[model samples]
Target: MTLYLLIYFIIIMGAVVAVISKKLINSAIMLALLSIGVSILLFAYNAPWAAVFELSVCAGLITVLFVSAVSLVKHDEENIKENRVKYVLLPLLLIGFIISASIIVPEYFSKLQIFSTYNTQKEEPIGKLIWLYRGVDIIGQLTLLASSVFVIKHIFFKRKEADNGGKI
Candidate 1:
């Protein structure tokens, strides 16, 4: 319970950093942290297959994409300086949402009989279940990943080539 809560807290913190960072590289690193925290939580909850997928797809492949995109972008120091002063509102908002959800979600879930049913559904071997029943979802995720890589490469490559007098 404490361990799970710690992982969730790390997830929230990493997510907030990912959303609010001014630097693209920082954001990508935070996104990796968020993925790692999520994978840890999924593993702790006994969903190792889901954890592995999340770690590989989200933390590994997606982070590589993000870092590549970040490398292709020019960081404007002026824009970063302008956005640095948030006056604590973002922290307050995140804390408020976390505190509220922590209280309400569990209480609400406890009143439902469906959660108990939901728990039993994951008893099958996760690999068999995912490949058999969730094959379409995997295909979709792969398609999305490939498209993102292509788009990022295309856009950045064009921009760089143009900046270099269209040499290559």
Candidate 2:
């Protein structure tokens, strides 16, 4: 639908703007916008609960977390230097792996009878749909929550230790 396209366009544009922004705070705001766009798109697709989660967790909590991180983390020259190599390598490796998978997987998958034989026509209630049909999603969300909590705790703990002159 036209509405879906428009909402998707807004989400993508917001994501691009967020990634390209120079200021961390600006990027966080843009990310929040992107998240809101996704929530709207989800609502348009008749997934109100998913939209709510997207708005609350991705748009609200994640944006607040980003703002907190940007404000808390001191951007020193040494920190930048130490992080530069690790960040560059990680993305490069990830992109290379994605390109490899995209090129290799489709051709191989086409020959496989299993992919061609999988059932496509199925429906279930929303509760059963998420819990039974999409269990991995629940796992993934839990993983995300745990990682976020870990990162926030680590940052504050390090800050506390630094404040104590590395005593604690």
Clash count list over all predictions: 0, 0
lDDT of 2: 0.82
Question: Residue 57 in candidate 2 has what lDDT?
Answer: 94
Give lDDT tens digits, candidate 1, residues 1-168.
789879988998898887777777888999999999999999998888889999999999999988987776656533555545573468887689979999999889878756464554547676787799889999999999899899979876645576779876
How accurate locally is residue 111 in candidate 1, as Cα lDDT from 0 to 100?
Answer: 84
Highest-lDDT candidate: 1
Q: Which stretches of candidate 2 lie over 4 Å from their true place?
A: 74-122, 130-166
lDDT of each: 0.83, 0.82
What's model 1's TM-score? 0.68
- Residue-wise C-alpha lDDT for candidate 2, range 62-117, written one tens digit per residue: 99988987887747423553544554465567579869998999888877856576
Query: In the order shown, what is each candidate's alpha-carbon RMSD?
Result: 4.4, 7.0
Scored by TM-score, the top model is 1
